[model samples]
Target: MKTLSFDGQRPCILQTASSVGKKEGEGNLTPFYDNIFQDAYLGEKSWEKAESKLLKTNLKTLLEKANESPENIDIVFGGDLLNQCISSNYGLLDFHIPFLGLYGACSTFVEGMILAAMAVHGNYAQKAIALTSSHFCSSERQFRFPLEYGGQRTPTSQWTVTGSGAALIAKGGEIEITHATIGRIIDYGISDINNMGAAMAPAAIETIRRHFQDRNLPNDYFDLVVTGDLGSVGKQITQQQLKNYGLDLEDRYIDCGDKIFDKEKQDAHAGGSGCGCCASVFSGWLYYLLRTGKCRRILLTATGALMSPTSSFQGESIPGIAHCISIERKTDNQ
Candidate 1:
């Protein structure tokens, strides 16, 4: 079975925190963000260092909100879009906590959460942190072009979000991590780097389908079924493909990419992308809704286009993966 149920003392999302750059701060969900920086460089010498600072700020906010010291957190799982995951490495070094870095592209946050929850559930750690970040300036230089080039973006292209989000998972809280489904890498021969939505939609569809089947749950089981960084194109493709499989998501379906920014106003061609797109949205707005009881159940499936600049340069098709986790408001009876 692809899905695993944490039947024993399900791990809880104790707290969440987020920090974003000016562009993301201008988005509709900015009100929920913990910190916002007007400067893209975040007072650092380079975009890379700024990204590292963004991640550090997010973790610091999370620790403060949870009122826990670094010693209280047994382990931390984090990653980013930067080469060698420098953002998470340098950002978290000050905390002096044990760290395990991951690389799942845009799906990194969900990947970290799954690992953290599993660690707590298995008694490996009493508290664990799942975090990720991305910076637009840094990502563009690495994956596309440098800031000086002023490259034009395609309509299908997405803007990488400059932000970070962190979540603390422990044994007790109002929101429980109930189940999770690991995704399989699906490549449909899509080589266009700009059209990530098309390349990743298949994997999102497959993971959602498998989760529903494995859990014997209906389409409407979750109050909301959200995908990470699919933007407009990928969201449309996922909805259409799932319908073909006889599953109707209806209005409960949403994508973090689409939710984070206003396409028309923000000039975000397709919408937001990158690790921070989903991470910030989930840790900020979505967490608020769950905490306030506006939402009872949520299925967060973060998708990633698993391709590097080298792979794309070599004309290799992009492979996509997604990981789904179920978060439910703990009922009084439960």
Candidate 2:
């Protein structure tokens, strides 16, 4: 079975923090974020350094909110969109905590959480932290073109979010990590670099279906089913495709990409993308809903397009992957 259930001493999210750049700060979820930087550079010399700073700021805020110091965290799982995962490496260097870096493209946030939860559940760590970040400037340059080029964007293109999110996990909390489903890579022969939503939708659907089947859950079991950075195009595709499998999401489904920005007002073409898109939204808005008991159960499936510039240039198709985790609000009966 691809899905694993945390039946004993379930890991829980004790606290969370989100920090975003200037453009993201102006979006619809402004009030939910912990910190909003007025400058994209964050007073740093380069965009990469700024992204590292953003991640560090979020981790600091998470620790402060949990009233725990760096020494209390047993391990940290983190990553970013940059090459070599430098954002997480440098950002967490000063904290002197044990770190394990990961790379799952836009799905890094949920990937980190799954590993962190597993660590705590297996008694490998008493306290673990999951962190991820991405910057529009940095990702744009690496994945597409440099910002100075002023390239024309297609309507299907998505704006990479500039933000970071961190969560502190412990043995007990208000929100429990109940189950997790790791996804498999799925490709539909999509090659357009700009249309990542189309490339990743199939993978999200596969993971969602497997999760429901493995757990013997009904289609409407979860209060909400959210995807990581599918943007508007992928969200639509997922909704349409899932119906063929006898699952109807209807209004109960939403995409983090869609929720991160105001589609009508914001200039974001299709919507938000990148690792931080879902990271910030989950840590900020979704966390608020779960913490406040507004949402009882949620299935968070983070999607990612596993393609590189070199691979794209070689005419290779983009393969997509998604990882799902089920979170539930603690109740008196349980």
Off by over 4 Å in 1: none
- Candidate 1: tens digits of C-alpha lDDT, residues 185-238: 999999999999899999999999999999899888988999999889999999
For residue 9, model 1's alpha carbon misses the true position, in angstroms, by 0.9
Which pairs, if any, clash in model 1?
none
What's every prediction's RMSD, in angstroms? 0.9, 1.0
Candidate 1, position 24, lDDT: 92
Candidate 1, RMSD to the unseen true structure? 0.9
> What range of 10 consecutive residues in model 2 has the weakest lDDT sum?
325-334
Query: Which candidate number has the best lDDT?
Result: 1
Which stretch of 10 consecutive residues in model 1 shows the poorest summed lDDT? 325-334
lDDT of each: 0.94, 0.92
